[model samples]
Target: MAGVGLVHQGRTRQYEVKVTAYVLFSCFVAAMGGLLFGYDLGITGGVTSMDPFLIKFFPSVYKQMKLEKAHENGPYCRFNNELLTLFTSSLYLAALVASLFASNTTRILGRKTSMFLGGLFFLVGALLNGFAVNVAMLIIGRLLLGFGVGYSNQSVPVYLSEMAPPNIRGALNMGFQMMITIGIFFANLINYLTAAQENGWRYSLGMGAVPALLLCIASLFLGDTPNSMIERGEYGRAKIILHKIRGTQDVDDEFQDLIDVIEVARQVAHPWRNITQPKYRPQLTLCSFIPFFQQLTGINVIMFYAPVLFQSLGFGDDASLMSAVIAVAVNVMATMVSILSVDKFGRRVLFLEGGTQMLLCQVAVGTLIALKFGVKGEGSFTKSEADLLLLFICLFVAAFAWSWGPLSWLVPSEICPLEVRSAGQSINVAVNMLFTFGIAQVFLPMLCYLKFGLFFFFAGFLVMMTIFVALLLPETKNVPIEEMNSVWNSHWFWTKFVPQEVVSDHSSSNCKPSP
Candidate 1:
């Protein structure tokens, strides 16, 4: 009875500890880097959907495409179609290269400083984009923007995961995704007000600089993550920063845990190479597939071309943009559901449930597209049919928001052992960006040729994703970072889904308790 009471009290305290003001501030600032990514989505997605934007930049192509599509005649250029794809998709290409190199950048410079450099790059890129006079300058600006995106996406998640407590880590790390949706909503709102003006895209694109500037300036006041500090042999400073982050003084045991894991790893000269070893294969596979299937779920297709999708479903241009605002707004709100429940529910449960629901939503949307719009673009739906199409798209976004969207970032950051975390996370995020580029580059062409078949293509991938999660993924909530090796080693189909006590007892047999 006494032991039970002691255990209960300890669990209560775990949930009761307050996160410090400075720590929360630093997280918000780091998450602003996510906001810049969202701003780019909002600014570019919305601006490109506008007639004035197309008319101004690619006059010849816009005119020709309009003529082909039966819209009123405009100035025509044959080059616009390919250039438009390059204009926006180049960012992801640049981002992929940056992410590939980010493993070394974070290790050498630390998370906080690396993020500051990312923000500075984004700011410069936004300035170039907003003031560009020629096609070459705009493409250069996009390359720079992608480069910063790679750095921010790779560094921020690893930083947040290390800094946050295991209990609340999901919510706090997910703050990055939340800020991203917020940035998108605001970008749409800004573009809605400006999409009709001749030079309004300049303002919409320029506004991306604000969040980048803030994140960079705020990074100056922050300290490095505990993991980074430990790697640098700054034990004393690591403890101080951990104290500041956790808002407590009794960190001796936790600090010891860090020392034990890192010391064992310190012996390996090329720790990053361990990622390919036999024991680590399951973890490496999980890290690869989670992000890979995440993009395959087609949320980016929905997010990046939201207005165009709505317009095809028969909403007017202005109405399509407004609907986009609502779609992203739903995305922000639904993510809060996962944020509140993720820790309580465990990772495997929510991911399983959410992944299944997402598959259903995609299937339903595809069926509706085939029925109402047909395989070709010849027919229009009634008001009720159009409303249902809109509802399904928003439903699909909400499903992704609560599942793969945040978890893609969360699980990768959490599952990697500290020894190779930076390198592993860089590889994972780069895969995400690479797929993002492929999706963004092909979506318009698919819509042009495949017409209604695209949603079905994404739907098939979601089916595979749902099965993948059910068969392989284990619960990661509140698992100690040091014990990830044990978790991966013992991960059978249901090892992690049982009660925590059972999992702990089972995992304990395979590895010695840390001193």
Candidate 2:
């Protein structure tokens, strides 16, 4: 199964050099997409308060413009329930549509260009939203903005993963996911501070422009993946870029390594179709479900609906908004822990540890919420009751942030071989975003309808997720992409699990790396 033969050399000075400093510098610049994602999702929580502020603070303008009716459905507007929900969830609606096209768009435009397009949409959408006078106009801005986010969410990781070295792959790839949490933390903090001010929602919406401009500027200097360059047959160009990316003066050796990988792809005859052949079966299974099940566990539900969930706890605006900010902070901090542990502890351990921890936290939160609403009754909570409920929910969010939040993005990038990295990453991302849209859209209504029981439902799903991770996922901490086929073809998979005949060793060497 060592088709190209194992090239292991233990730890060397090469590992100490921080090869990705410049590459990750570029990564940091491109990660503006995540900031936009976090800001847009979390901004709505603060934006909802705008209707009340407009009604009370901007009364003459509110009445003159019919903005007062906008809050009729909630505190801001009771007049239009559909419009209110649309205003609240329009990003998800656009994200769902964008997910359908994002992969194809990235394929045609290439990663860097795709990200640039996303930035353009974000910029226009932010301006439109800042100036929107009606619900229809806000929806248009959100739809355009979500298109950019959907594209970024799908393309950025593949780009980063393809560029990252194997040993630190999880750390770098997870950084993209980590930026998302940081974006949320930053967004929520901005909103919390601004929520009581006049026209604060406009400021919050317009804040998206900050990251959009940075992304647009950053894309200009960024390098496309070596895989992309290889696929396009720009080998000499890929070599030069890889030198700059790795920050090495030695281009000759690196060029040969890339060429070696590309040659493997050439022998496979059809790299994409080989994913279904017995040898590539492990990668196929990991690619499809690693991401889909990540969503099935219901992380997005919490992210998209944290405010509503806090409101259900009988907290007032100040308490709920403050708690949401804390939750975002917890998410950011916990992900940092994962970043520190992922390389040392390995992927399988992180998932097992994080998933099980998350399951327990969900169960406790579920029980607490159920007991609070069902046993204590919903009219008003005792001081202690409110505190306990808040503590439990915070713990639940912390658990998710540490475990699924970053690792879900990290594992998929590492598991697929170089031959199928981009396409496989695209598939995984498409599944994640598609489910993210569906789940984010329904979570609020499901909670409104299901009430406290929603926690228990999610808790059950969390357990299922924990079990699947324990039973199926391989530890990929040090496994190089070229060696993945060995594990994929093992008898453990061949006899006991997947029953397909493994692709012979002779054929494995032929699956070339790009360009």
Best by TM-score: 1
Reference-based lDDT, each prediction = 0.76, 0.66
Against the true structure, candidate 2 reaches a TM-score of 0.84
Judging by lDDT against the true structure, name the best candidate. Answer: 1
User: Per-residue alpha-carbon lDDT of model 2 for 424-451, expressed as tens digits?
Assistant: 6666766776676666656655655565
Model 2 misplaced stretches (Cα beyond 4 Å): 1-20, 53-83, 104-109, 251-254, 263-279, 375-377, 494-515
To one decimal, what is the Cα RMSD in angstroms of model 2 from the true structure?
5.8
The C-alpha local distance difference test score for the whole of candidate 1 amounts to 0.76
The CA-based lDDT of model 2 is what?
A: 0.66
